[model samples]
Target: MTTALHLAKSDDLPKLSALVAAFHAESGIEISDEARTNGLAPLLNGIPHGAAYLLGPARAPVGYVIVSFGWSVEFGGMDGFVDELYLRPAVRGRGIATEVLLALPKALAEAGMKAIHLEVAADNATAQSLYERTGFRTRDGYRLMTRVL
Candidate 1:
């Protein structure tokens, strides 16, 4: 039932980092708090490269989402990638994510974001189907390639 995405602030870092830690652990990502803090602090401090949002009450968020901005000549303007999304296990399948996915991108688009993109595990059909419901189409013949610097 939680559908609001409160933009994060520097003062919220401790709580937000805990949520990110939980999400990373659940996803099998081995990350240190120092690393997490380093990454999140800039965004929270208004660095413009990305953003994080608490999904639900600001004091007791049920989940969080991170979005990183980009520019695409192909898309003709600014775009964004859903860098990460996480919901507490107790809250899955209740259509909270569905509501967020459906509403967030539209809100972003209205704010002049040309497009929003997300990556799903090739095997996570449920997530894929969920994203597809929100009008995210798989780019035919294209796979996301990345190099970690």
Candidate 2:
């Protein structure tokens, strides 16, 4: 089925949250309900400096993408992070994701964003391929390291 993407509204939070939780579970990442409740709620509601979108038919939201904005000197201006991008497993293999990635940058650019970025699991070849096809290249000199707060 072909799905269209739209700016996510507050009413779509429950479905978006479920999809996020499922993605977390499938990836072995533990996401607390409190985080979803307290954190995501505000972000999706426009209380934060970011945006989220839902992708699916008009009747339902089957996937979502969350983006956060930031300054990037390297990119010469504002940049964005694709904090999340997910399509239900049943909807994979179709070109929906590719189309989304292809279209998103134009929208972001029009909003004054200079670049967009996303992190994928090193072993996720499928995701890597999709990203590469969309013009994302691995930075040769950088390693992503993080410490939990």
Candidate 3:
């Protein structure tokens, strides 16, 4: 059996950091310790006000998901962004990630969120398929652009 772990407190930082670092490494995204530390501060503080959850056995975290809040006039109210999701390679094929994706919207709705969004790399067909299977569809009308300043 699998369990869902809700990380709603500052105490969850270490586990979250480890999981994110593992994900970055596995995905070939080079990140520094300081970057990871700085990046996790908001999630740890629960600032920008969001939640992180883990899926696996109760004591060990095999995967994690981070959700953040935002306003979307198009959705007619507050929406959620799935900021990050990562499951260990060994555990990838077991449908756990699919379960987490399915469950997150319900959890967010309970918190009064109206919608959820995520961005997967254009070439990442595996992830796109999973998202589509879970009710997320691509928006063809707009292009996602970003600038680092």
Candidate 4:
């Protein structure tokens, strides 16, 4: 499937929110509506901290991707974390996500991002395999650890 990505704008909030809510519910993530709004609003409003992209079509996107930026001396410069990526159930396994994964990194790299990262559930072998094919690899002796503030 050939799809395009649109950088989400503030006006796209309602559509983005609906898609995010669907993704969260499907993935068993339990976040409140307010939290979701708080997180997505900044990205949509052109905050340098991150960006949200609507996949497929602006009017009715098939999926969405959220990428957050951070300075990483270890990586020699800016790095991006793919905070969220989701495709509607009807679109999964059609290479749409793979295309995004492949294309997004190159775009980021061109924009001076040194590296990109994403976390997948340990048991989700299918996702891991796809990520690997798209050039992601497990780092030996390192694990992602996070604490909510």
Tens-digit per-residue lDDT, 27-135, candidate 4: 8999999999999999988899999999997799999999999999999999999999999999898899999999999999999999999999999999999999999
Where's the lowest-lDDT run of ten residues in candidate 4? Answer: 1-10
Please provide, for model 1 over 71-139, each residue's C-alpha lDDT reduced to its tens digit, 9 standing for 90 to 100: 999998999999999999998998888988888888888988998999999999999999998799999
lDDT against the true structure, per candidate, is 0.90, 0.84, 0.82, 0.94
- Output the better candidate (1/2) by TM-score: 1
Query: TM-score rank, highest first?
Result: 4, 1, 2, 3
Off by over 4 Å in 1: none
- TM of each candidate vs. truth: 0.96, 0.92, 0.90, 0.97
lDDT of 3 by residue, 115-148 (tens): 9999999999999999999889888897768897
RMSD, one per candidate, in order: 1.2, 1.8, 1.8, 1.1
lDDT of 2 by residue, 17-93 (tens): 88888878887878698787676787767865788888887457778888988999998999999998988899898
lDDT of 4 at 47: 94
Q: What residue pairs are clashing in model 3?
A: none
Backbone steric clashes in candidate 4, count: 0
lDDT score, residue 141, model 3? 97
- Candidate 4 has which clashing residue pairs, if any? none
